[model samples]
Target: MTSNTSAAPRAARRRWATLLALFAILLIGAHLRFLSLITWDEPSSRLHPDERFFTDVASMLHVPASFDEYLDSARNPLNPRNYTKNNWYVYGLLPQTLTQYAAVMLSPQQVLPACVNRPEYSDPSITIGQPCQDTSLADYQRKIVNPDLAVPKLVWLQQALNAEGRDLTGYYEIFKVGRTWSALFDLGSLLLVFLIGLRLYGRRAGLLAALLYACAVLPIQLAHFFTVDAATGFFVLAAVYWAVRCAQNGGVISFGMLGLSIGAAMSCRVTLATLGLLGVLAVAVRLLRRDPLPNGQEDTTDRSHTAISSPRQVVTLSLLLAFAGGLALLSFRLLQPDAFRGTSFIDVLPDERFIENIQRISTFVSGEADSPPQQQWAGRTPFLFPLQNILLWGLGLPLGLAALAAWVVAGWQLIRRGNLAHLLPWAWVTFYFAWQGGQFVTTMRYYSSLYGLLCVLAAWGLVVLAAAKHLPATRVRVPSMVAGRGVAAKHLPATRVRVP
Candidate 1:
């Protein structure tokens, strides 16, 4: 009874410690992102031109008048008479449409007033009194902004909102809100990394991983900005965590959670659909290995009779159902014809065309290609970019070097231990690194995910090293000490060598 009472107190203390650690990690991550928000590049002028397009989409979503106009304009191209004439569609319609719908729901009065009074503007070339010219000023603006010639809905939405007397400031605020919400997704990703580390290794590993991830330059940069990368990271981590847990537990709930995580990640960034494949492969591999469970039963052995009817099986079934249901819900975009158009995913798979595109993308990401006639590669090499930036921007050279060394040692130790499961995460890191190396123009931002992963690995390595050093040593006499004492028949004892 006394022992049981003592155990309860210890358990409560551990729970409290875990909660405190989580809160601390979140606080650190928040500070890193908030610092960037205050001091980092501004979107209006400093960010890449593509960022403006996303903002424009966000604005269009906030106003209804803009939505109607955009729809009408989309159906009727700038040069309706000339069927061959090119009309660039500058923004993604879905994101913008959803944003506008959400804004309208949140603050209808503010959004409606701006949309209702929008100004009457047409393509400049197409005068109101004169016959419509080949193209209008509005069409030219759309074409210039969206040279890709896809998704013109956002431009139309923007024009409509402007016409309705909605100033750019109001639209900007709405965009900011969207960006803020998107950034918060990174916090969720960090939390999953912590939980996964804790489960796989221990509390120390979890705390260290979370701390390193929170302060890591790449995650910090990505999280502070109004981009989809943070969201993508969150889903990727979630999917991996749940999938690993399911593989370990072999329960329906675990599988369901895994599926849901993968589905959500894919929804955030379709490219992450590869992770779903990885998840399935992980489970299949584990089952094939026929590892025994803690209960002594072969993991792959059937127990359909009693086990299937058990409460655990029921819970597992429910989880699987939820996961499948969530995935089905998220995959609704697959039905949309316009999605993935012109991309390799739609046109080819493992074909020459796909390979060539991959090569080109790799080249573009690696900072190896000559800069375009109009643009320059900012002299950022894929491998060196993260190291240099993190040293200069966050930690100093000494600390950065220490971190790198720790990571290298940890990777080597993991390899020595034959911890393939732990090393599996780094496979993606290696792929990204190789992909970036082949690119002609690598950006510091592109290496964010890799850097974040490595930092956690490095922290784990440091923890291991520290533990080994602290282990108590059994003292033993050295032969060298006897040699110095000279031969004395009565005083000298038999020499013994130290066993390290």
Candidate 2:
């Protein structure tokens, strides 16, 4: 009784210690991301043009008239050049319209007409050496012209700033808030990693996987920046995790969750459509193998190798339920018909310009692009990205070798005792690397998913090595001696049975 009670406390204490270590890793990840947020110099030019658009849409949600105009204006592509060049007119109008609405709600008299007729900021300044410009304008009249126009939203933001007696033009503050929000998303991503790891592998493996994901430098840097990459990555990981879980558990609800996650990931970034293909392949493979369905029905064995149980039937029902729950959110671009020119899926092939862009980026990475672009690789390489990725990204090479070694020694051991569930994770890692090798562009950011998959295999490799290290010599010797004794040993064994 005392031994049992004592053992329980030790186990509990070890569990707590493990939890502390994971929490420490989480804190370190947060610090690394936040440091980048505060110190990193963002290019003064527009950052994440897509996210800027999202903010505009969010702001416009507070006002009705502006939202209607914004939607209507987006639909009329009769003037594409006007739409593209004057995108600011549509984008800027949201903030202004929202501010106007705010001012009316908070302070009415200060409200002015919406500044739809505002002059462009690029209008020639007096500093230009053209004294004869606008000859009808008198000097005193020119001085009275207001250079700054107050949009309604800006006005409300200004008034709010004044109420707090703070400077309204602190660009850094807005950036800081955006950065903080991005970091929070990173934290949420880490939490999801931990949960997935715990569910897929045991607690120790889960913690290790989460640590690897959180501490990965490139993903960390991306998380700090106000970019959609981090958000897209989070959803990608979530979709993969839930899909794997559904596959393992074989449940209708689990599969529904998987679809929802995949849809959300698609909404976040269209590139994640790859996951949809992977999902279909996984389900099809299961059905071909005559695996039990999620509904607990056994697959028909009479079907040929090519025949698969209808995933369409399963997935279609799941999608219907998911959409009924309002979880199937469409992409903003998908809903806005005018901007995308109503191109059908079949028409949206990679264009010549896109191919040229990819080729340019590829050449830049491969040291064959323009000289000016090459200068961007100053000191940050070898340690941070291109160099680190080229070097450490091949860490999987060694792991592949180790896995081969394990296959030789542990073939019987695995057949007898190993969980086949591990194959899914290992296959995913292999597929990721294979995909990376075939891609034209070799940016480190593109390999983030590969990096994650490798970490899991690395952990598996460590476990294999540790088990080999601890193999009992006595067990090996006993088997060897029994083999050497040959035929008569079993018959003679009863003659002298000795206690050690």
Number of the top-ranking candidate, with lDDT as the measure: 1
Measured over all alpha carbons after superposition, the RMSD of each candidate to the real structure, in angstroms, is 13.2, 12.9
Each candidate structure's count of clashing pairs: 26, 2
Number of clashes found in candidate 2: 2
Candidate 1 deviant stretches above 4 angstroms: 35-48, 61-102, 113-170, 288-375, 378-403, 406-415, 472-500
**What lDDT would candidate 2 get against the real structure?**
0.43
| Candidate 2 lDDT by residue in tens digits, 246-286 | 54434566556666666555544444555664455435434
Per-model CA lDDT versus the true structure: 0.47, 0.43
Question: What would the per-residue lDDT of candidate 1 be over residues 407-435, giving only the tens digit for each residue?
Answer: 55535533442233353355555555665
Q: Report lDDT (Cα) of residue 128, candidate 2.
A: 14
What TM-score should be assigned to candidate 1? 0.62
Error of 1 at 489 (Å): 50
- Which model scores highest in TM-score? 1
User: How far off is residue 204 in model 1, in Å?
Assistant: 1.7
